[model samples]
Target: KLDDADLKKGLERSISTDIQFLIAGQNSDGGWGWWRGSESENWLTAYALLGLHEAREAGYAVPEDRLARATRFLERWLTRTAELQDNATLDTRAFILYALSESGNGDESRAVELFDRHTLLDTDGRAFLLMALDNAGEGQRPRVQTLASELTARAILSATGAHWEEQAPDLRAFDSSRRSTALVLRALVRVQPEHMLLPQSVRWLMIAREIGHWETTQETAWAILALTDYMRASGELKADFSYEVALNDKVVLSEKATADNLSDPVMLKVGIAELLLEEANELIITRVTPSEGQSGMGRLYYSAWLRYYLPVETLKARAQGISVARRYEAVDAATLESLGAAVSTAQVGDVVRVHLTVNAPNDLFYFTLEDPIPAGFEVMDPTLLTTSHAAEAPGRERLDPDDSPFWYDSWTQSVIRDEKVALFSDTLPRGTYEYSYLLRATVPGDYNVLPTFAYEHYYPEVYGRSEGSRFTITPTAATE
Candidate 1:
């Protein structure tokens, strides 16, 4: 299988694409971060490095500067003093150690010290660290060897349930997901290379059928990676191992699990190796030619993979990678009391939360405004803007005082785009603006403070879009 040139080409393309995508997210400070403009996560950076190194070894053209920056990213953090200072506390140290080991660099003194401190939790960080130590063998710090073995036992050993205080306890026996089980197996194999974990690991992957770590593709990939590693180490890579193997989002490797030699882990090992190799191969082989204008590495990959995996009819119906900007605008009707007591002018001398009623559906919608705000006035919580009645399609309920709308501080001038997406991206423009609400101000009588909101939606579907409200305030209030 290793001699197959076609397989190598596919693997090379798939891995190189993955690494390049990760590298594209590198920050100016030489660290990799998740999402846009967030603080750097050292563990992710290390994984990027390790992934890059693996791809390079597999014949991918990973740029040298990117790899150096990835490594230096961790080095800079390791030596710096901050929330990331204590190598013993951060999971990053484990990831860094793994990358260093994979790099075949000598004298990872700082990394070893961190592992010696037993900082790795029973998560991905711990599993990878143990594997790195095992790969390093006697050269690894004596303390790491001892601690890794102990931790591995804890992860793989079965229990009635999750017992935190017992020796050789299982942290996730209650977790019936393939993702958790895979992590447990990762740690276990690192501590005991050929140790048999078929009963539990198989149950985790096959029974629970949970390959997602809550919500991500990493769990499936990681679990398979661990199983393949175990099979290779145990010399079980000669038979056809069976499970679900997805080449793309459209395909899952749910082939028949070939009967294995009950006494031998060989058949399972061989079958998994094929899937791993094929999965990588299928990622690079494209059936559809993407137009040069397509954006996003993963998006393009998804398209290509779908072309190969999905039926021809479905591919024709699938929409290209075009994203539409959608919005929902809401307006509330005026009641007698709501309109009786009026707020003529909202001033800047208090802590405020805006709660304007709107008719909106269950989908996420953006709220755009043509107004500005005073300084110090900011939305305390844009996440829970819409009342619980939000999820009810179209229900009614009083909001908490915090949910009430008011001017907490004076605003100056700025363009504000309040992204009222239900996921709470917290991605608002960080500046002050003078707010000119069209809602309550709809009444002409001395700013008759409308009972609910007024409707000026960018899109017609936006009802109850105020689920996320926008506000502002000045540092200096009228009281000051």
Candidate 2:
């Protein structure tokens, strides 16, 4: 039984911790990167600035110097990009303008100038620009209204809900269609809360969520912001309702909700064995009318998830959004020459290069690849100092740049574990990429190599895997 005071204190503590982390990660250039120690980027800096500004608005303490430095970085970035007239930077420019406006440092004239220069902007970019104009106190301006109308006209409405689509590639790894729609929703909620499409847009956002969460962190944050604004504008916070859940015409659960417990979730669990039928199972939810003169208000949202598992061998390689294939090649330990492909037999100390080919038809963020090795083989740790035949020093096995079979840019980080090699990237653009790592046959035995798998870290629905294989490592002639 937590009270509002407890929740507020917890939220403030979390905000304070996040603020300290952001401050500690600020680069020397008064900006942020995809991660600490990476190069500082303009949009990343603006994002951090916006976070700090929101914290300050919420009564959290934010260092003035930090805010000033980040503001200067965005200002300088906007000026330089404007001089270059790079159309590709339109999204960045609009986002920076919005950040500046939210922090009370925006220039209305400058925002108008940017809008004039970039007449053609993507959905998210246009939304940001609209937000900037609104924050700059130009929400009623003719041009601003025109932009808002254009956005409203582009809304894709269905019987159940409405949403906007993004045609341009995302500016950052975390950007997504959900985030773009959420941004547009926020802009409309602020500029025209009474618009007929606003409620439908909010419905679309709610429906698009996977369970209770969005696709990415950025999408979730923006969606929450948009939904919060919509709730406040529409006065949809209070709840007073009774609902019942039925399974196969049998009442399973019933509950009444009120304003005091509107945020609480009603959950029901049933074991598979308890199911009434193996197929065509029906679960229904009904909103019950209040007795006597009492009335019902607000809405009830529910989600149902079916959990099951299948044999590992029954699962085939899936290429719904991403595909991955792996092959093994035996190579000369001394000359680094390829001996053969799909080499199943190798002498002790032989080097085997495991190659993974990944094809992503669309841009993906936070992708990871995992390749499990046979127990008889040991990974060649590139970070270690070793003289083993397979443990070639980093940068020693060089190949012609044009003739190289591996794509080095596919991954930003890698780990060599005892039985697997894992590669990770913040973003994987639409293309085919090949990555390879070395392994040495050590123990003499027949071993099974587990399937190599890859997937988007945040959205596991997009995933792929390769077939497993067997390998045989023989003892050296001298040892025999």
Candidate 3:
């Protein structure tokens, strides 16, 4: 129902909103940080500038003043690195150079001079420098060819496709082999589109996706750019083909696609009740060939997903790469003594502590933990005052001598919600961590505690959870 004009307007509006947000987050120094209000950093600022430049090239109206200020910040950063002789990584320097060149604010001769100073360069560093030179209209230079050749020589080729790997320790959290391969592929597409490894490298990136997209945002962005460049260079955008989807030897759907709808996705949904069988069921997809003397060219990509749910109690504990375990213990409010791990019953005015233990076999990024509490208990917020009855209870003054109520070793943020306590961390190294928080048994009732769950924010496949528990609270002597 929508036409080209409608799509154009929608895209423009989206870009305008994004530009406004990016400008609003820019610091007074004209640089960006990992998050708003944080100290500005070099790499994040360069990444933002590159995005703005690309937006402008796509015919979006970006404020000239904002771009100029960001450009000056990057220039100052590069100058400081040289003046102080800081051992900045080659990849960082190369990326900054590429961004400045794309914005038409870089000196080609100086960039080349800096590039020559680095005797050793990683895969990312070489790719960025090649793109920088290409942006500066020096793509045909001898030095550029040398860099391109070196990259091609070091590629990891296989029957499936070709790719490059990243071995830098500092970039492990933010970078991966897919990202490195995408960047190198883009550079090669610009410098030598006829190279023998181009097709295989493109294949590698296409098949490396987790499902519909790559692992991280950085990886997805670079992969899209690389594939777009390859498409333009090879004139492979047009398509004329028909495909059929068959389930259990019966055709369920058939469709034709042309250049206009080549980018659109075709979805087919069938209920399990209709397709479920006691024996194995097969679903097959086939591309219909053109008539005699007709030809079809291009690629077809598809993904199949099966969705289902099960009862919480039926789900057993699983640990792909990370594991979590939780326990509860009742404690005396006055003496601060441990009352054992069994919290099956507690007095109405007693305090209970919830402990969570997590173990990671390898480094994981953007980790999160959620532990749901029983309705009969109320989470203790350290910032608020305790109830009057608990405050007046004997030995209550000795509960916290230093006024510190929580104990956690490795978490960036912790939040207490109405029914659950959540903990978050940007990165968790390989180790064991324990976190504990206090709760008060305010109401008298029997309640069920939900399971404690934890997982990597980006890759949900790596996750773990603990079994649920139950507890009961009895009325105090005064209430009884």
Q: What is the C-alpha lDDT of each candidate?
A: 0.42, 0.78, 0.76
Candidate 3 deviant stretches above 4 angstroms: 1-14, 58-61, 83-88, 117-119, 270-282, 292-295, 306-308, 328-354, 360-422, 426-431, 436-480
The residue-by-residue lDDT of candidate 2 on 1-480, one tens digit each, is 346888878987889999999999999889998677777889889889999998998788999999999998888888788765544588778888998999989868778887886566777878888888888774536767877898888788788688887666554434566777799889988888898888788778887888678876778989999988987787666777788999989999989878788767777998998886657889999999886654687777777878886654455676768887877887776776566667778888788877777787787787888888788888777567773554443221112335464425535677778878887888876777777777777889887667788888756667888876677889998757
Instruction: Return the TM-score for candidate 1, rounded to 2 decimals.
Output: 0.47
lDDT of 1 by residue, 113-161 (tens): 5565554344545555665676676776565566545544555444422
Model 3, span 394-447: residue lDDT tens? 111111234444433445567788889888776777666767777788899877
lDDT value for model 3: 0.76
- TM-scores for every predicted model: 0.47, 0.79, 0.75
Find the 10 residues in a row with the least total lDDT in model 2: 392-401
Worst 10-residue lDDT window, candidate 3: 391-400
Total backbone clashes of candidate 3, pairs 3 or more residues apart or in separate chains: 1
On TM-score, the candidate that comes out on top is: 2
Candidate 2: C-alpha RMSD to true structure equals 5.1
**Position 33, candidate 1: lDDT:** 57
